[model samples]
Target: MFPMQFALKRGMKAEMPDMDIARNLDIEKPRSRSNSHNEILTKDIAGALLDVIRDLKSTLEDSRKSLSHSAGAGCRCSTTGTTLSTLDEYSTSGPRSSDMMGIPPEIMSYVRTFGHEPATASDLMDWLTEFEDTMEILGLDGQNGTLDKRSVVARLALKGKARKVVLAKRAWLARQGQQLSWAEVQKSLRLAYRAHIPEHAMESRLCRFNPQEHSEEGTGLLIQRVLEIMNMGESHDNEYRLFYIISTLPDDIKDILLRRPCPTDEVELIGRVEDIELLKVSMAMNGREQGKGRKR
Candidate 1:
């Protein structure tokens, strides 16, 4: 009976090794399946990333083409499409009046159209100044001849009512055998558009221009307005213009100006005012920053 029992126990021990092998196989099978699933997930992620990269590349290519097309067309694409379209109308090639006037596309591209309304007289003056500067830069100014380059540029620069007035003036001059000059065009436009205020009235207006009242417009604009008024009327003595501007400024600015010897000219005064404005802005920002630090 003892010998039989020993043989049975040995058989049971052999079966135990087979059961252990089966358990190990079952565990390894799941690990293998998990590794396969991970590989598939990794492949899907890589494919999706590749697709995103391809889409970005396509979009970038389209943007480049659009910008290239806009540049070749002589008008820049921008949020201000209407303005660009108006500029394009004058810039495009054709047997148009501007072309006949000898105005080049390069010049037209740089020149802005006149007679857009809700524009102040000061605005017109600013535009005229810019137009003259652009002409001078292009070597078109002071060309002595019947058809002056500056005159042609001025003609091409005008639009709407301003253009009509200038054309009438030009035609009249032509009938009298006199060619229109850039200077004449300037005078005509100023007379037609600039406010016809008397010299004394302009001086009064300048004196009344309070910088504090226009604080929202910034110091630069306030200075510009003062200078514009000074230019429009008969030239004042530098001392009087300086006194006028200094007296009308805010008390804080006036105090700062008084500490320095008076500026010799409007240009010098403007520089000083700008410096003071910058200093004040810096000090205000510093104060705010220090306040924040204290709260913290």
Candidate 2:
């Protein structure tokens, strides 16, 4: 064993020179680079795996977005269906057709006040068309007109239903012992046109029509005479105040004004300023003459 070890050392010493010579010679060693091709293949495989992973991630993201969109659409459809079902139930439970046919007499009377002349059938039909359109929008059909709204409205001047209403009103007025005077008619006209006139124009209109020269100038004069008769005197200031007072007139007086065929009272027309002083002077003169006769 000792001899073998000594020979191995001697051999290693001799091989050292050969090792040095081989190192000096340009000899190719058995190469780890033999496995470099495998390494390159592995790197290519890694790159492919990365590309697949990236594609898979993009696909997953697109799928997620599509699913979210589908979920949102489904939610909207369900909400819309529920809303439609609720509306359908409400419509089924609402008022019936027969209850919507009748129109209120008060509303009819208000329409009547728009003109002194009786409304033609076509006029009424046009009004009805407009009113029905309004009512349809409001969902107020099939309801009865209220009966207790007796605001002393005048009937439109005409035959048939309108004439009948006027006749009935006249009879009612007679029972109440009321007379439909000219003053009343004037007041009604004022009430009707009150909303139409501008505040500034009323003064000019009144000024243009002098009672002496233009008594029958226009409808304005009739209004002036009516104002005088009612003791609604000429004020120097604020013509619009007078108009406001006229506009806010009592409903009873307004009704008389609206009625046609002005009523008559047997008493002669007299102004308070003209009559009261005359009466006082006449009574004083009569007393003085009686005292003079007694002294004689």
The candidate that wins on TM-score is: 1
In candidate 2, the residue pairs with backbone N, CA or C atoms under 3 Å apart (3 or more residues apart, or in different chains) clash, namely 99-142, 99-143, 100-141, 100-142, 184-257
**Model 2 alpha-carbon drift over 4 Å, by segment:** 1-124, 130-195, 203-247, 258-296
> How high is the CA lDDT of each candidate model?
0.38, 0.30
lDDT of 1 by residue, 172-277 (tens): 6546655445446555545444322235454446544555555434444545655565455544343244334444555444434432222322344444454534
**Clash list (residue pairs), candidate 1:** none
- For candidate 2, the lDDT comes to 0.30
Superposed Cα deviation of residue 238, candidate 2 (Å): 21
**Reference-based TM-score, model 2:** 0.18
Worst 10 residues of 2 by lDDT: 147-156
| Tens-place lDDT digits, model 2, residues 155-220 | 111112222223443455557645433343334434433433446464435533333232123333
